[model samples]
Target: MTLPAFELVQPRSLRDAIDALAAAPGMEPIAGGTSLLVDLRGARVKAETLLDLGRIDELRGITIDSHELVIGAMATIADVLKNPAVAEHAPLLVEACRLFASPLVRNRATIGGNLAYASPAADAAPPLLALDAVVELRSVRGRRQVALAEFFKGVRKTARKPDELLVGIHIPRAVPGTLSAYRKLGLRKADSISVASVATRVVVDMAGRCQAARIALGAVAPVPLRVAKAEAALTRHGLTVEAAADAAKLAAEATSPIDDVRGTAAYRRRVTETLVKRALLELVEKGGDGR
Candidate 1:
């Protein structure tokens, strides 16, 4: 199906793009156009004009500064995976991108589009949320930043204002003595929305106790959820198989899952527990933990 007739504009600067978003009614920004194109085909999304963000050089690169990992809005999954800095400092981002759609889709999907679309199953959100990322939004009014926890409202919904464009994302550096990992369960190896997913960043004491932990989940609720209760249960606790299992159960209980085609709610709940258990155990093993 063809998208309905629409005007297309390529803005060269941030100011020009902001003016366009503010002025154009029923206008949509296009980075890779992966998800938007699908919605357009189904008539689920309609736009009078397409604002092409591809040419905005300001929104097209990756940089790691002392303050945060700064990623432009237009950086593709492919670009993210190829950046050595990402591999070295933020492997969870690379892990999520590795499991995204196919190579074809990955090459064309932008980080900004993925976050703004706010799919419950989007792989990036869980990791970014775990990392305490902040999303920067720009409009004619001004710019503001929202933490990942506050940005997502519900399934397919976000705090993004109608006239705002996502300018970039900032991920605070993982603190010293922190270990992080991500895991996703789908119906198949590829081409499936996440049935369940988990991202964890854990800090351990020199004595191997969990000092702090962040557990962010996806695909099991209206919005990506943080298993705060589960994380709390693990923090300051001794590393043990029993401890990990119990934490997983708490994490599973935290999800308000609903029945879906990929799996039943019961199955997803069970998977969530199993995934969290593994993630926790992996952290211990990598840190040379006896547990």
Candidate 2:
């Protein structure tokens, strides 16, 4: 498929890029061009100008602050998987990256693009949401931070304005007893979109009680969701068999899946419950304290 004719602008700095986007009518930012190019060719997106973010050096890097791990928006899936800071502080995100796509696509797909695409099945959302990640948005006007939980407004929708560029993802450093796991139920293991997915994080105290719990699900709703009921169940019961059961049931009930080519609504609900239970059990089998 051929993309519609569009003016391509390559800017050396973030300021220049934002300037171009703000000046052009129907201009959209492109990073990696993995998702945007396809959308353009498929007529899913229309644009008269394309602002390429590749030359903007400020939009790339990985670092750790005293309180959190900061990953540049342009970082690729491979970059995240190999970053030592990411591996240590956000293992659930690393696990999600492992299941993202094939190597060829992963090399070209930026984390910012994945989140900006705002697909219900985006592999980046559930795990990052579980980690209580924050997204940094920048524009000619100024910069602002939005919680990942509040980033998505709906399907293919986000709080990001047309002039704003997603600059970074900030994830809090993992606590000592934090444990996290991610699982995606795709039709095939490689290069397939998830039919249903779950990511969970639990911080268990030395006394075997869950001090903090987060359970997030994707592809079964209009937006990626943190299942508060399920998290509460785990927090109250500390991942016991009964607690797992209650959490699973709540997760299944909370999902508003629809019949689609990937899966039936009933199938997704059932798998959601099973996967949530399995992930909690895996945490338990790993010695429960997340150490």
Candidate 3:
């Protein structure tokens, strides 16, 4: 199907993009056009104008500043895989990128577009959530930062206002002794959306005791979620098989899944429990080397 006719506006600067959004109703921002184009073609979404952000250089790089990794909203999945800063600061994000889609799609799919599309199965959200990432939103009024946990309001919905543009994502640099891992269970080995996914970050001391844990789940909830009960089960405890099992059970219990073409709620819950346990056990065995 062909996309509906719409006016395209290419803004040369970030400020110009913001102004365009503020001035026009029914103006939708387009980064890579990977998801938006498809939505438009299918008539799932409609817009009178397209605000192309590709030319705005301000929204297209990855940098580290003051102990945080700042990724420009326009950075593509391929860019994430290639950037040394991303690899060093957030390797689990790389894991997600590798599993995002085909190479062709990865090259054109911007990180901002992925998050903005707001799919429960979005590969980027779980890892970013586990890393305690924050998204920066800008508008004519001012700029505000929203925690990744609070970014997604519901299915295909986000906290971004109509006139606000997502400019960047900020992630705190992982501290020493922090181990992280990501797992996605897709129907196909490649190029398939997740049936259920899990990302984990565990901070452990040399004594093999857990100081902190963050377990984020995707595709099994209305939004990507950090299972606080599961994290609490592992926190301040020995990283033992028993603890992993208990935490896994809690994680599974927290999910609110629905029966979809890809999977049933029961299947998703079982996968979530298994993946969480496996990730925790792997972290314990590797002793902070979650490669």
Top candidate when judged by lDDT against the true structure: 3
With a 3 Å backbone cut-off (N, CA, C), the pairs that clash in candidate 1 are none
Off by over 4 Å in 2: 289-291
Candidate 1 TM-score, true structure as reference: 0.94
Those runs of model 3 whose alpha carbons end farther than 4 Å from true positions after fitting are 288-291
Each candidate's lDDT (Cα)?
0.85, 0.89, 0.90
Sliding window of 10 residues with minimal summed lDDT for model 1: 282-291
Instruction: Report how far residue 205 has shifted in candidate 3, in Å.
Output: 2.2
lDDT of 3 by residue, 124-160 (tens): 9999999999999999999999999999999989999
User: Model 3 clash tally?
Assistant: 0
Q: What are the models' TM-scores?
A: 0.94, 0.96, 0.96
Over 78-169, each residue of candidate 1 has an lDDT whose tens digit, in order, gives 99999987776677788888998889998889999899888888888898888788999999999999998999998878999889999898
Q: What residue runs in model 1 are displaced by over 4 Å at the alpha carbon?
A: 288-291
Q: How accurate is candidate 1 locally (lDDT)?
A: 0.85
